[model samples]
Target: MSTHVPFNALRPGVDAADVRAAIDRVIASGWFVLGPEVEAFEAEFAAASQVPYAVGVGTGTDAITLILRALDIGPGDEVITPPLSAAYSALAVMMAGARPVFADIDPARLTLDPHATEAAITSRTKAILPVHLYGQAADMRAFEGIAARHNLALIEDAAQAQLATFDGRAVGSIGIAGATSFYPTKNLGALGDGGAVITRDAQLAARIKRLRNGGQTSRYHHQEAGANSRLDELQAAILRARLPYLADWTKRRRAIAGRYRSASVPPSLSVPREFDAGHVYHLFPVLTSCREAFQAHCLVQGVETLIHYPVPIPRQPALAATNPAMCPVGDRVCAEIVSLPMYPALSDDQVSTVMGAFSSFVPPTR
Candidate 1:
């Protein structure tokens, strides 16, 4: 029988003993939602990001929407963001009743091109929502300059970049406010879907706290009509348990990425470059002109691979008024990027197996 190495090896209990214990602890507590667990997790997460406050929300999408809504970015407001990203960040803009203006990415980092973001600005542009795609922070220094010049809110979508830093500061802490997800696949994932809006701004944090709780300033007294999107105590507990382990886990992930970078491969394939304190390698993206054949070749070697995004943002039908001409880099990058197996749990043998898969790869013959 062939040994099969999957794209993501994330199994519960065996992989996270503390997570299992936390779940049991929460279950016994009887108070499952918006309790001490959530409060503590929020505090701990805020500390991890070097921020003063973190408001827990139902999901990453809600975190984004709440942050946007708290800032009063709505109706006629335009938020500039990278076109090549998970649809939820852009959709959050829509949820907040704002228009999402697609901007081309820097081909090198695959984050928003600072020039493209600045060029997209108009009187209608009220904010810049930059996604730290694939566990890497964007060039915040450039973005800060742009935001200051235009007086636009700089919000970070840090769903994939838990504990990832840029320059000397944590990614989520640099912007006006940062939204992050704890989806099962994320580096700092909870047991299920969870998210938080972290910020140094106390007023923004207060507004978000109210926004997530049906706009209740107090118990049962509604202030403004808001969505119910509180993060549950159980998930928060799981996150708290896992939080202490993240730094070390990231180190292992870095080691794997280093190996992948040093490995010799076919001329057609190109691995991502390491950025100092910027990338946490959430998904190790490798590009190839011949993506389909490369994926097929890996499959034959009993190694699995997947694409982070197979379709460009403009190509997605759910989004309205999407134009591929507006984001040429994203259009081309989507066609070629493939995610190799990259989770902290991956053994050295598995890493070697993937490297071996690369050595045996053959291009498809016409």
Candidate 2:
């Protein structure tokens, strides 16, 4: 009988007891929103991210939008972003009332190409938003130079990359501000929906905190029109319980990815090169021209596979009015990419099963 390999397992295994304890503690406190648990999680997350401040929000999308709102980037402004990421990255810009300009991705790194981003910038461009796709860091060094030259904010969409570093520097801290999600599938995920903004700017952090809470500097005081997007205490507590185990989980993910990398694959499939050693291996995706057949083959072997994205963000029907520009590289990548099982919960037998499945695949000749 062939061994079955799941794409990911969300049920808490090693941290089950701690997770239960956290939920009980939150229930006992009877403080459900913007309370001590959220406050403490913010500080702890800030330290982990190597940033001075972190503001918890209702979701990752809100975190990105709030960061833009705090920077006063909206309405007539334009933000350059990669087309290959989850549509939420661009939708977050739209939520801020700013238009998101689609930029091509670096074919090798599969990230927002610095050159393409710089080219996309116009006089109205207020920011360059880059998604750290598949847990790999974008070219932050080049992006820093581009932002410096254009006087634009460099915001990192680090939803897939938690505790990932770029050249010894932490990802979220390298940019003006970084946004992350804890949507159960993430590396440092919470029990439910959660997100945060990390930054070194104290004023920006404070502004985001106020902005996330219905624009209130104090109770019943609406200084400006702000969205209600505070990270609740229960989710914060859950995240806190899971946070300490993140480093080890990241290491396990990296080890699994390394095994995948070292495994012999057929000529039809190729793995993307690891651009940085600090990658936390959020999702292990391999490229193949024969996506449908490859997926079928894996499924037969009881190995579940998924596509990271099948369409470029700009191509989504929701963004049709943005007059979205064509991203040739992104379109090609979307057609070819597929994600294999990559989670810390995967056992040694599961890993070997996945490896054997990949090794045995032989693409049908045209």
Worst 10 residues of 1 by lDDT: 317-326
lDDT of each: 0.88, 0.95
Candidate 1 local lDDT, residue 220: 95
TM values, all candidates: 0.97, 0.99
Clashes of each: 0, 0
The most accurate candidate by TM-score is 2
Tens digits of per-residue lDDT for model 2, 1-366: 878898889999999999999999999999999999999999999999999999999999999999999999999999999999889999999999999999999999999999999889899999999999999999999999999999999999999999999998998999899999999999999888999999999999999999999999899999999999988999999999999999999999999998998899888888999999999999999999999999999999999999989999999999999898989999999999999999999998899989988888898988
lDDT of 2 at 116: 91
- Mark the regions of model 2 whose C-alpha exceeds 4 Å error after superposition: none
User: Residue-wise lDDT of candidate 1 within 1-366, one digit each (tens)?
Assistant: 446789986676344778888989999999997899999999999999899999999999999999988988988888888878898988898899888888899999899999999989989999999999998889899999999999999999999998888987898899899999999999988768899999999999998888899999899999998889999999999888888888888998889988988789787888766665657889988999899999998898878999878887756787756332368899888999998899888888889888888766767767
